[model samples]
Target: MPHVIVKMYPGSSEEQKEKIAQEITNVIIKHTGKPEEAISIAIAEVTEDLWIQEVYDKEISPNKESLYKKPGY
Candidate 1:
């Protein structure tokens, strides 16, 4: 069994996340000789404030809102 964890800013579409999970599972199954059902994929959506990075003492926020027209429901 293979486990994969993906963490990103909280603005990805459901379709996008599903596609990514499927693709990742497929790749893991192909390379690791594991069954598709044996591969596990998890996605973690973090808030924009939590996804910040500091550059030269300046806080840089990731533009997660631009990923979709409507983010959270």
Candidate 2:
């Protein structure tokens, strides 16, 4: 069971989010051999003002070893 959470600046439309989720699901299925029904994706809209404290600092910075692609910022 794998759950993916994507946190980004808010602006994407529902269709865009759906497409992104589908693509992510496809990749996860391809790599992990997990069925679509076993994967869950969540998109969280984080504002720029709160991104550092809420995301980068708390999540990315602390989990650098786990990150596959680190942010340049």
Point to the candidate with the largest TM-score.
2
lDDT of 2 by residue, 38-72 (tens): 99999999999999999998999999999999999
Q: Best candidate per lDDT, number?
A: 2
TM-score of each: 0.65, 0.96
Clashing pairs in 2: none
Clashes of 2: 0
Model 2 — TM-score against the truth?
0.96
| Residue 44 in model 2: lDDT | 100
lDDT of 1 by residue, 1-73 (tens): 7787677777889999999999988888787889987888999886667554432113223454454433342
> What residue runs in model 2 are displaced by over 4 Å at the alpha carbon?
none
